[model samples]
Target: MSASVDIRSVSKSFGDVHALDGVSLAIAPGETLALLGHNGAGKTTLFRILLGFIEPNSGEALIDGLKAGCRQARRLISYLPENVAFPKTLTGREVVAFYAQLKGAAASEANAALEQVGLGEAASRRCGTYSKGMRQRLGLAQAIVGNPRILLLDEPTSGLDPLSRNDFYQLIAGLAEQGTSVLLSSHGLSELEARASRVAILRQGHLVADGPLAMLQRDARLPIRIRVKTKPADAETLHREFGGRRINGASVEVTCEPDEKMAILAALHQRPGAIADIEVIPPSLDEVYRHYSRANPDKEARS
Candidate 1:
């Protein structure tokens, strides 16, 4: 079964610096929530609070309604840090087995965990001998050892190749299907577009946006780019007809509501042979981030 994570008005500070300020959000069971922000944002601090590595200065962090950092909360969660470190003297297999034993699983289960991350063949190799990507896989294997209900990953795809990244996402999708809630912090906005059910954007120490991807995009006032394909003359005519501005001779761009997308298509369809293709381009998360960041420079500069 999956567990939900609830953070309400959580604040954390280090000396005079505020790392997280009144952060509050809820991630439901079996959902994947992507955390986005620029460098120095509170992404790392938030993850640490969830993992019990740091105590919040105020408010609460809860897993399944239980206070975070309790034994019950620890048992239901796994964490994959941005940088994974393993004992140099230990073999990959030994490290995995050690974690399984700590989790009260039979040592024999380690091999299965290694296989799940496609590292079975290298299980006997010393941790010092593994490449960066291979070491990342080993860390992921350890996190998945007991099928914990909640998983927190920071830049999970870092150091992974294209194929490996694709496979990793597929694995995450399967975990969600099996009812494991995932919280992933990533800088790769494009990848999150397909992987995350919802995204929360953090600027400095504050959460500037939180909701489903579609909803966030809607609330961010993102522009939609429209394209119509036709002959140069027809394109020009259509551009004039619909007041479309030419991105090029054959392409036009417009900002409009998502629901109006079909209307644009219909307008072109009404004129037979006037259009060959139509496309609607939604704003990327990066663009949306810039929009908010620029609008609130002072707030975003605190961190």
Candidate 2:
């Protein structure tokens, strides 16, 4: 499928500093692509280029074949920055309605959008009195005003409580189901782990890794840990059979390659009570980051 959002060999430089270096990636329709990286890793800079706030020094940023910043692209792209500052005195409805007018959408649709973000009851309340999560929802309402095909959210769940965060992501999932391509840059690894269909990890200004989470994990080649609980009397046999270490009175831990997991489990099942309970630990987002960074330390030093 053709990409809904595309950045082709894009690069941006400021004097002696490079914010983006030959970066290229795409977001397919209905896919959520998480941008992962440390501070100064070019995620925000890429977002700015994609949103058409700034131009890249080379190559292209395209939204559904329209050049970035073109009139048509404006109608198809919506952005929510990390800091969603707005006029403190305006009611939430007023804030959304103002953006609706800017997007050439009907002001009457403002309440509908606010309701979609769970702001229906607080629609008439002034922004200054709204809590952080409420303000975030108000900002979200503004972004979805014109029914854009692409959404760019930067740290969107910031300041939200756990319940509010769940609500916010549900809203994002609904948008994706409607074929909206989402590029979300966030520091919340576990949240992204649950929601992102794919991820891109940036180191300094370079794009080091990009693909489905499972694919990246496989490429990282980290061990899969399996901990098995067995009859205390059989612990020694289990450890020797699996080349594992005894962790406690009845528990043994073994490490295996991804492809070896099922085979190892099948071997353990041959003897009764050989394993009472087991847990498989897969590579986490945090480990993936460490794996890639360690492999790319030279790139960081050069940059």
Candidate 3:
């Protein structure tokens, strides 16, 4: 089946600055892809190109095989910007209803969407009266009203509290499960680490890395970290044998190559009495992201 969203060798430039450089990606139905990048990392530029707000200097972006920015493609996509704003005079219900009309969805969907985002009680209140978290939820309600084939979210959880953030993610997960292709961009690397099916990192206008978390971790060749908690008396012995540094009176921290993880675990298992607990941690998304951001692409290509 064709990808729901596809960008082929797309590049964009603004005079001296190159916003994107030959970035290509594809998202399948029901897939949730995370887009990671720092400020000016071409994330917004790429979103604009896909939204048809601007054309790329080279290559093409397509929404379900249709050229991006075309009417049919636009109808297939929905976007929630980082900062959501609405006229202060309009009520929450009015705001979403307007979007529903624009998306050709029934006005009743506005109320259902608002309730889905936990804004039901305040739906009649003017947006000007809503708190930041409430406003964010309102934005989400509008974005989801029509159930577009592609959903694009930017800094989606910015103003949400912990509980509300959880709800937000659950809602996104449900949408993806129902066949919506979601492309999410956020600075919350830790959150995306577990939720995203695939991750695409952009650095200095280059597609620095793209893959599942495990694949990126493997390709980056980062070590697996192990922290062992032992009896105070056993800590020193474990440290001596394992060659890891002591973190505390009862803890020793060690790192090994990815391929050595199983052997190390087996060795640790043999010392049941000395080891009180063991925690094995793989390279995190943040670590992998930093590794690629600083990696010299030119050197990597030559190697």
Clashes of 1: 0
Relative to the unseen true structure, what is the Cα RMSD of model 3?
A: 2.4
| TM-score pick, better of 2 and 3 | 3
lDDT of 1 by residue, 138-186 (tens): 9998988877889999888888888888888888888988888999988
lDDT tens string, model 2, 1-303?
889999999999878889889989989999999888777888899989987889999999999989988888988889999896899999999999999999899998899999999999999989999988899989999998889899999888878888888888888899999999999887636656467888888777888888888887777788899989998788898888888788977999999888999998888778766678888988787877777755665643343
RMSD of each: 3.8, 3.3, 2.4
lDDT of 3 by residue, 11-117 (tens): 99999999999999999999998888888999999999999999999999999999999999989999999886899999999999999999999888899999999
lDDT of prediction 3:
0.88
The model with the greater lDDT, 1 or 2, is: 2
TM-score per candidate: 0.83, 0.86, 0.90
Clashing residue pairs found in predicted model 2: none
User: CA lDDT of 262 in candidate 1?
Assistant: 78
Worst 10 residues of 3 by lDDT: 294-303
* Top candidate, metric lDDT: 3
The parts of candidate 1 lying over 4 Å away from their true place are 1-3, 234-244, 248-250, 270-276, 285-303
Q: Model 3, 236: alpha-carbon shift in Å?
A: 3.9
